[model samples]
Target chain A: MLQSIVHVCLAGLSQGMFIWLVASGLTLIFGVLGVLNFAHGSFYMLGAYFCFMVLRALGENFWWGLLLGPVCVAAVGYLVERFFLRRVYGLELPYQLLLTFAFVLLFDDLVKIFWGAASIGTPPAPGLADSIMILGRRFPSYNLFVIAVGPLLALGLWGLLEKTWAGRIIRASSSDREMASALGVKVPTLFTAVFVFGTWLGALGGGLAVPYLGLLTPGMGEQIIIEAFVVAVIGGLGSLKGAFLGALVIGLLSAFGTRFLPTFDMFLTFILMAGVLLWRPQGFFGEAR
Target chain B: MSKKGMNRRQFVKAGLMTAAAAALGPAVLKPTSLWAAESKVKGPIKLGYQTVLSGTLAGYGEFHKMGAIMAMEEINTAGGIAGNKLEIEFRDSTLKAPDAIQNARYFVDSWGADFLAGIDSSGQALALAPVMAELDRVLMVTHAATEKLTEEQVFKNGVKQIFRIVTPTYQDGNAAAFVAKDLPVKTWATINPKYEYGFTCWNMFKETLSALKKDVTFTAESWAPFGTTDFRSHINTIMDAKPEGLYSVEWAGELITMVKQGIQAGLFNQVKHVMFPVGAAMDVLEGLGAEMPDNIWISGRYYFLYPNDKSNNDWVERFHKRWQHYPAYVSEGAYSTMYAFKKAVEAAGSKETKAVVGALEGMTLDSPAGKRVFRKEDHQAMYDVPWGLTVSNPKYPFKIMGKQVMVPAKDCFARPPFEGPGTKPPFKA
Candidate 1:
């Protein structure tokens, strides 16, 4: 029983890490831009597809995909922010929402045209396919790698945000956009940079997740986007720390729920979201407007 | 103000007449015009094909379209159905129930389709089944496999317009049980998508298996929402239960994900037997190629290399020649449905909807899947269910079924004339 509990916890933690990776990006973008960026999930999908294409074309280590997939997605993100998103900065929230949602449909069709409608699978990276014995039971090494990534990324992001001048500028701008611009922070350029970085984070999550999930399908982004949104909301919109916590809560709930209450697994996440909304509308870490 | 100027009462009367005309004009004129135009069935017999043209299930729809296209081309080339050229108008359902119903109506009302066919999801099939009766049109369901469409919805709802070319889920479940009884598996667990088809599949398999093997126990059950991308937690939960065998009803992309993740988690290492009723689909094999493990049991509605008959082999060759990829069951279902429609039309000696429905009730026709008989009682096809073990064959790039087990339709199918456990007479009568 104890071992089973341990297994569930480990599975939950690893799953949470992936959710955190996605939710963090969404939260970050919302925090700085005050736009929901519904296409955040599309970037993640592109990451997976791009990584798969790279791996298929250049037969080498999986590292190639990890290194280049996010870069490609980041470039696309940069262009999207510079051209389309730039126009919507001063518009109503609905326009920004509608514009981002349009990107979702556009990318969905684009993926179908390029990748075809069939799902594609990538083989496990070399040396990561096997399982290792843990707590007298076998656990996938790939999941361990996934679990480790969340904390590593969180620490890196913390350092960048807290210690560096660029991070300081970004923080200042997000908090006081008018003041930052008055102080010569190049507000438009900073917004673009932040959007691109957030997109890269989403893409990185997708690339990292594809090998473990083992299949990539068009509209896969839409499936995960809702869960990511729930996490972002529960953790407090735009709060990176809250996103992590929310992901963990949802992931663990999913894992344990499957064991104890198989029928309500899908509803469990929503129930939590509802509870959070009822109790704390702004979210755990969110600031009042 | 002279003879042209109107009094206040006269002006009010003219305004009311104009408002009435504006409100009722289209409703009265549109249908009459459409009926007048559509009543003349002069040139070709049109079939309205509705299925998922986008999303994860698109492959099934694509294959269905391919198979239907091939059949239409052949028939058109060799003197079309009853001297009239057969053509299909395709519509994307997007795999939603509302969209499928809307598409079905559009096909019948707007395009004047002689018949409606093609549905990838069972839910769509169930939703559209009732609509067929409302439209007073015959709908040949090509791919959706829910037993409820024929067993409950057809008989209980008095829906005679719907007929399924694919084997019902109940029959497949019974076949699965037969295969399970022969194997060395004892304790069984199931992981299926949470939906009508999945639940019905699991229940039928379990009930039939329990009847066959008195000692068999179902240790664990897991239900994942449809189109779920992650199955790690589900996998861990199943592994913890440690069932000797697993039955998974997940199909297409979701199945690919589960199998691959199962391998990574070493779940297969612990479980002795695993069966995927729809896993032998060409798309699944092609997607997983070389990574698909050997000895795992899989079943398909139709396999390209099965029946080992000459005519079946010829059809396979012809399909491969044109499409370059082996046809999945959905493809065969669509192909056979077109031929079935042709046979029924020829038998009835008319393309009228009521006549076609009557002819199709107990029709027996030759298809690529060998001979199929649509039961008069329920309108469900009675055909062989093919199951096999996955083996790496040298001739094919992907894994092919080896040591094939052909479950005879006689043993698997329910008795006819609304005699099944869940079947009932129409409440209206």
Candidate 2:
């Protein structure tokens, strides 16, 4: 009984962490910027494709791909905020969604044009390709790498937001944009920077996923984005803490659901999201309006 | 009065002209060549082709386009069928049955398509069956492999307008079982696509294998939904089942991910025998490259290297030269389907739907996949596709088959009137 429990948890934890990596950027963007960027998923896809390209250019050097792939996404995010998203800051939610959705279609086609329709997957990280026996179940070390990275990123983000002056200004703008503007916060530029940072986080998740999933596809972003949205919703849409815990819960629920009730596995995540919203309408961490 | 009705003299003159032309035209137009022989056949035969073009499976559509367009150009360059120029319009089916039906309607009613080809999803193909009957246009299904399209929709329902260029579940399941019965395996498990194609293939294999060997047992099953990126959980399920053999029906990009993940989970080390119904597909082999583990039995609707005949070899060379890549089975099926249309039109001596359907039944054509006979009963093309063990070849970048075993189509295909339960077998085990 214990062995099965541990195995399920391991699977859930790894899956959840991967999702957290994507959801972190989403939660951060929505929290500070109040922009529900639908293209966040596209950013994740670009990260995987760029990383795969870099790996190929460097003869499959995975670390180089990991470090450089998300950096490229940061550059893309910068272009998006400076030119496109900058125009939509004062608009309503639907306008922002429509604008970001355009990027989703654009980026999906761009990836296809540049890389072709077939998938190109990265090799497992150096020395992390081995499997460890976990309670009589063989679990991949690459999965463990992903699991470890998720919490580390969460800690890094927590420190960056809570421990720095830039973080304070960003928080001030997020809470009261006019007051921060009056106090010389340069809110527009700050918003751009935050958006870029969030994009980088989403891309980092994509980079991590290349090895974990063992393949990069054009619309993989669309799939992961749906999962991230569920995580963000359950964790409270704009709450980082909520996203972190929510990812874990969603991941574990999906894993256990597949193991125990295979037929209902598809609905388990959505069902959890609905139940959580009914009980704590603001999610676990979102402030009550 | 003259504008509204034909005058007596005008009607008499038209009748005399028609009779004179009919008497003299046959003697003047001598068809020494097949195209010249059928002077009555029309010009500019229009074909509408549709397949998935926007999703992760978009690569399949690209391959379909390559083969169909290549054949169109070739037929046109050689003076076309029965003196008619071949023209083709390509559309994206987008993995939806409704979209496929809409495209079929537009192809026939709007684009004036005389014939159609290229459907990648079995759901889309099965959905288009009744629509084809309604439109009264012949649809040559290239990639979809559901047996129900042939058995239930075509054979049982008498949807004569639908014909498939690719082999159906008979090859994937029954032929696969014929190969497995000799492998000394008693128990099996499967991870299949969670759709009609998956369920049908598994059931077909189980029924045939059980009938062939009474002692064989199926231990467990996992059905992965379409577009499933993560397959580790499914892999674990198969591992726990611990069957003597594993059979996976995953294909294309999904299969690539499954194999890579399965290798990481040490699936190859645990299972002594494994089989992939569509593992020999070009994209999977090319995507995995050196990562693909050897000795797993694999087969597809068509293998580019099989048949090893002069005609097939020559065509593969031309195809590689043109596209700079080897042909996938869809491309082969699509390419052959265009030629099949040409043959039918020439045989029937017209581009009419009823004539073409009649011409296609029991017709044989030499293709890159060898001789394909459009069976008279169901219109499903019957041909030999061999099951081979994966092995690395120095000449090719990916793994090629090492040893291949072929069960003759006569031995494996379900017999006539192909009903679900009552269908007879071509030969007793």
Tens digit per residue, CA lDDT, model 2, A134-167: 8776789888888888889899888988899998
**Model 1 misplaced stretches (Cα beyond 4 Å):** B1-41, B418-429
lDDT of 2 by residue, B1-102 (tens): 454366567556645654664576456533422463345677789999999888688788888888998998899989898888999999989989978977
RMSD in Å for all candidates: 6.8, 8.2
Residue A86 in candidate 1, Cα distance off native in Å: 1.0
Q: For model 2, what is the alpha-carbon lDDT of residue B80?
A: 91
| Reference-based TM-score, model 2 | 0.92
Worst 10 residues of 1 chain B by lDDT: B420-429
Off by over 4 Å in 2: A1-3, B1-39, B420-426
Note the residue pairs that clash in candidate 1: none
Q: What share of the true interface contacts does candidate 1 keep?
A: 0.69
